[model samples]
Target: MVSSSQPLASLIGRKILDQGGNAADAAVAVAAALAVTEPCSTGIGGDAFCLFYDAKSKTVKALNASGRCPEALTIEKLRSLGFEGDSVPNTSAHSVTVPGAAAGWVDTVDLFGSKRLSLAQILEPATELAERGFPVSELTAQFWKRGEQRIMNASPNGHEMLRHGKAAPAAGEIMKLPNMGKTFRALAEQGKAGFYEGRIAESIVKTLGDLGSTMTLDDLKNHSSTPVEPISIVYNDQLRVHECPPNGQGITALIALGILDSLQSKGKRAFLDAGVNSVSYLHTVIEALRLAFADSKFFVTDPEKVHVPVNELLSKEYLAKRAELIDPQNTKAVAHGSPANSSDTVYFSVVDKEGNACSFINSNYEGFGSAIVPEGCGFVLQNRGSNFNLDPNHPNALAPLKRPYHTIIPAMVTRMDGSLHISYGVMGGFMQPQGHVQVLLNMHHFGMTPQEALDTPRICIMPEEEGRSVVLVEEGIRPGVVEGLKALGHEIQVVTGLMRANFGRGQIIVRREDEESAGGHVLVAGCDPRCDGIAVAQF
Candidate 1:
């Protein structure tokens, strides 16, 4: 089964699986295809993360393929550029980090891919999609249209992404990216060096440099993917939820789940027994997440650059202490506890017939990234560095060769018996972990199917002045629940008509292992209705 934000990309993943590729290969193919189909959200110029479940070992492994800042770029440089702010401007060239997705793609294949398929073969489908062109999906077209001005005015080579160098492509219009195809072919033929060393690397460095960015070819050459042990927390004693470690914010989901578990242990049933989407249920989940965010936002940074107390934060004792702060009937002001913590982008799930699963996410921070297309590279440079805080004392503050806080994450859930249960993720800046918590509980506690879990009305806790939170409830949520939340002193905003994308787009593939089932496993998948995507199963 393959599920992703773009239907054509999902088909490419399915094709890879049929062609004797494993989940890792299918995932990379989908990642590349999405780069062609959904250029507004992801590309080679961005970053990617993967959580792969190796069926044979029954262990989840993580790959942090996010890029680092240019070694010469600094807060002082931005200050000298006459910008005095807590963070770099969203579209500034200085915000362009080393593009990690290209190397990340090659690394995932090299590390977890089936040896049967060559890199060139795995990427050929996406390369073809880019060269031959495809009709633009409706939602993708809307997002592309929204970013048109940004690409045109802010990007030097922005005309490359535009239709005829002027307007955004309308839905159903065939859009071709021959330049991106050339980039893909270069990668296929030369592997990692094809992207990071030769013509493509020179183009990226020269383009950003002309825009006053300090990025150099060496930054691209030095980039490599880091594989780490995935961090997870046992949920409901039945399953374990896995996420990438700090600098990626996957820990935020674990911390939130841990807090909820602590609440359940303390006799808080409203979080579960009140039924899904009820005022009590939503309120409790929201409050727990708020507390989790309090911790994650304070502690989640590059662990290599700072000490992140991952063990202490996920410890049962600390979670119990944090759960004590939650009010069943109302919201509360929460702060970072000593224990510690923690989007944009594309999230997809792939599960091969052999039970190997890959939960993957890739992204360019914000739409079209910094909106700066690298000369002939046919992709936007990710403004991931825009996530960095300018306060010199902050742990996530911009520093030479350091990764800023990353929003894109991939997730997986495994049963206690060490079998893959679900491969999934929710993609959107800040809404990611929150979506993970809601969707997981929808299935684990309420017994909803994968589709039901994704279709349910979602709520996002948007930050407001003075640390207050305004809950953005999707349109389908009952009106009484909205009023009930407001009465509890929670600020409420009902989102509808296109603005709801802020809540996020998610994908899920649930694995049911049964000796009697076909191939001893049944794969059920769901794609987000909020975007242009689908879930397909291959026999």
Candidate 2:
């Protein structure tokens, strides 16, 4: 079974499965296809992360395929450029980082893929889709329209992404990305070297250099994806929730879940009894997430460059302590606790017949990221480097060859016995972890099916600004619930119509063991209504 934010991408993945490829291979195919059909959000010129469940080993592993700052980029350079601020401008060339999605795709296959399919075979489907052209879906076209101004203003080659160098494509308009297809063919034939060591790499350096960036060819040539240990906190002992460790914010969901469970176990709040979306349930969830974000904002950074106390943060003792702060009646001003510390895009899950699951996310951070397109590459450079802070003493401060705090993450859940349970993720900038917690709980605590879990309304705690707490409440929640939140002194911004995209586009595929079937497993999946996507199963 395969589920993704783009319909064609999902079908392409299922086709890989039909060709006898494993979950890892199918995931690569989907990632490539999304880049072609949804260019405003993802492409080879971005970063990717994956959590792969190796059923044979009964273990889940993480792939941190994020790229780093150029070796010459530093706070001093930005200061000299006359900008004095906490973060670089989102679309500036200075914000572009080494693209990692290309390397990430190849590495994921090499590590977990079945040997039955070659790299060329795994990528061929996406390449064909790009070359032959495909109609733009409604949601994808909306996002593409949002990127029009950036693409036209940020790079000389940006016009390639627009219709005849003038406008964004409308829904149902057929779009062809031949240059992207050529890039894929290069990758298929030469592997990682095809992207990092040739014309593509040169074009990347030239594009950035032309815009006053310090990036060089060596930055791209030296790039490689990292394989790290997957982190998790067993949720109420019913299931283990896994995410890629620090630098990605997946830990935020685990921490929030831990706090809620601690509250329930302490007999302070009966969450299930509170009922989904009730005042008690909503208040408790908002407070716990506030506390979780406080800690995450301070502690999540590149682990290779600084210490992130993962174990101390997720400790039951710490979670219980944090749980003590939530009041049943009001919102609280939250700050990072002492105990620890730890985008536009496509999130998809693929579970093969063998029960090996791959939960993957890829993004060009903040649509049309950096908006700097390499000549002939047909993709935008990611503005991921904009995530870095300017405070020299901070762990996430900008520096040479260091990664910034990353927002894109993939997640997986497993039964206590270590069997694959769910492969899922939500795609949006800061809304990801919040979406993760909400969807997982809908299924775990409220007994919602895969589709119901996604259909439920959600709330997002916008990044704190000027010490104010603002929450974006999706429209589906009852007005009484909104009033209940506002009565609690929480600043509520009701989001409706097209603006609700802020909630996220999520996908899920659950592996259910069925005693009645000879194969013994049934795949159940769902795609978010917010996206033009679908979930497909192979017969």
Candidate models: Cα lDDT each: 0.88, 0.89
Candidate 1 at 363: error in angstroms?
0.5
lDDT of 2 by residue, 121-143 (tens): 99999999888989999988998
Q: Give the Å error, residue 420, model 2.
A: 0.8
Worst 10 residues of 1 by lDDT: 335-344
- TM per candidate comes to 0.98, 0.98
At residue 64, give the lDDT of candidate 1.
95
Clashing pairs in 2: none
lDDT of 1 by residue, 1-539 (tens): 99999999999999999999999999999999999999999998899999999999998999999999899988888898897878888878888889889989999999999988999999999999999999999999999999999999876788889887788999999999888999999999999999999999999888888889998888888888899888989988888889999898888889889999988887777658778999888888888888888787778788888888999999999999988888776777665422111135899999998889999999987878898898898888889888888989888888999988888888999999898999999998888999999999988888889999999989988764565767889999999989989988899989897788888899999998679986887888888888899998898
RMSD of 2: 2.2
